[model samples]
Target chain A: DAGITQSPRHKVTETGTPVTLRCHQTENHRYMYWYRQDPGHGLRLIHYSYGVKDTDKGEVSDGYSVSRSKTEDFLLTLESATSSQTSVYFCAISESNQGREQYFGPGTRLTVT
Target chain B: AQTVTQSQPEMSVQEAETVTLSCTYDTSESDYYLFWYKQPPSRQMILVIRQEAYKQQNATENRFSVNFQKAAKSFSLKISDSQLGDAAMYFCAYRSARNQGGKLIFGQGTELSVKP
Candidate 1:
């Protein structure tokens, strides 16, 4: 278990509402990633941060945004929720020397009505 | 661009038996990494094994082992003496060796059921 946790394990929000999910890690890892899991799609990267205040878009970055102000915290926000955004979101982290072997958090299930 | 594909959507194996899951990836780069991640009912992604493309020998972790065929671009996972705990969704992922933020391309997934 990597010391990673995602707040609001589950949530239901209406369409067009703003929602933000938080990922907190204690390992002080330099790499943090956000992914969404859906049926038939194992998991798709949403966004990732390499260090404090440095971020990049992933394969599926539309409708989502991320910010990393500190090493331990990463935030993913949905500016306006939509039905297509309903899915399980996961947070993962890896050390600088570990290459791409990432450890994942428990995950957050968000529903858009 | 890199892509990973898991042809089997579902598979089942009897307890104590051996089962192999198939994975194939497409990449122009010769240097990269392949990984198998297990997601149980708890929904936690656990790293089962990994193989570096440059290595000729296969990689193994306890009961989990990988058959890496670089020329064929195939990576398969073999589970020996399978147990109930092995029942879960298995995912195969590919990452380039280049320092491109270590992004990973994942397969759809294969749901593995272990019969006890």
Candidate 2:
């Protein structure tokens, strides 16, 4: 797990509730990414940031949103959590956005009931 | 669209033996990169090995190596001297050389079990 850290490693929440996961990095990497892992789907990108206040949608960005306000903090928010959104979320940082070597955090396991 | 395929869903190898995991990718782009990632029970995605499409030489890292065939669009991971700690889910990924956000496309994944 590189120098990245994610809060609330495990959480059990109710459906329709809102949730926000935080990813903090000690390394001043320029790129940050948010991904989700499920049983069948290996891992799908939810969102990514190139710099502070810059973010973009991924393949599965429908029910999720992300924000990066500083060099070390990237946040993922689920405005309205759903059962389908329950999955293991991972945060990664890379020095370059060219898809170079990315260091991942431990991961946050969110469960929606 | 680029796609990665890991044919083997599950694989077993004996301790101290060797095993190979196959991965094939479909892409029209000529320049890109291929990588092998390991996700153990701890659930952290670790970079196992990487190979650049332009590089002809195979990439080797300690106990892990990769056989990259650009012509056939194939990249396989070979683990030598397997250990029980090697048991984990391995994922094959592809990244285009373009500046198109640099998103990684991953295969379904193959679960590797090391039998002691």
Candidate 3:
């Protein structure tokens, strides 16, 4: 409902391979975030971008990288996939300066074997 | 550092009945925000309600309301006249009003079921 869409809704990749998930939003929100959801550990932020070429690490930023060149697109890349990286990745956007109500994308499920 | 905790792993309620989900957070900052998000089987995250720590009065939206006790650091969600659509995993999250860039810290989550 927030005009957010995630590409490659489901993906399976072998260990040590490179994978990248894309999040595209039409709302032109100023802040975009990437998160991973796993059992027993709610959604953990992977990385986030406040504006073009500006990014910051989150609670769980290891083994992942992100880049944003435009306001509508945010990309999360797993340099080398691992079994531990297998989980559902979500993308969120917020218009405010502080973390407030964030609209989420459909989510991408990536599997590393 | 801020943390959110949802003690209940699972809960069930009969349709048309009222059920409350518990959530507690630890934060040194006095001004912040608390939110309740519902993720149904479809996995779509829906915002149920939100409460600003600065506001003394609780926030409500239709059937969903929150009990915010800032002093106790407690935030709970109450669903009245629960329906089958309410069956989902509920998450409590905290966001600092300071310079966190709106980054949210989420709880473990509670799976709620509504039985007919």
RMSD of each: 1.0, 1.0, 0.7
Best by TM-score: 3
Per-residue alpha-carbon lDDT of model 3 for B41-89, expressed as tens digits?
Answer: 8888999998989999999999999999998999999999999999999
Indicate the residue-level lDDT of B15 in model 2.
100
Ranking by DockQ: 3, 2, 1
Candidate 2 lDDT tens digits, A12-109: 99999999999999999988999899876788889999899999998899989999999999999999999999899999888885648888999999
Better of 2 and 3 by DockQ: 3
Clashing pairs in 2: none
- Chain A TM-score of each model, in the order shown? 0.97, 0.96, 0.97
Off by over 4 Å in 2: none
* Docking quality category of candidate 1 according to DockQ thresholds: medium
Looking at model 3, residue B30 earns an lDDT score of: 87
Local accuracy of candidate 1 as per-residue lDDT tens digits, B1-116: 88899999999999999999999999999899999999999999999998989899999999999999999999999999999999999999998888778877899999999999
State each model's CA lDDT, in order: 0.94, 0.92, 0.94
By DockQ thresholds, what CAPRI class is model 3? medium
* Per-residue lDDT value at B38 in model 1: 97
Q: What is the lDDT for B9 in model 1?
A: 99
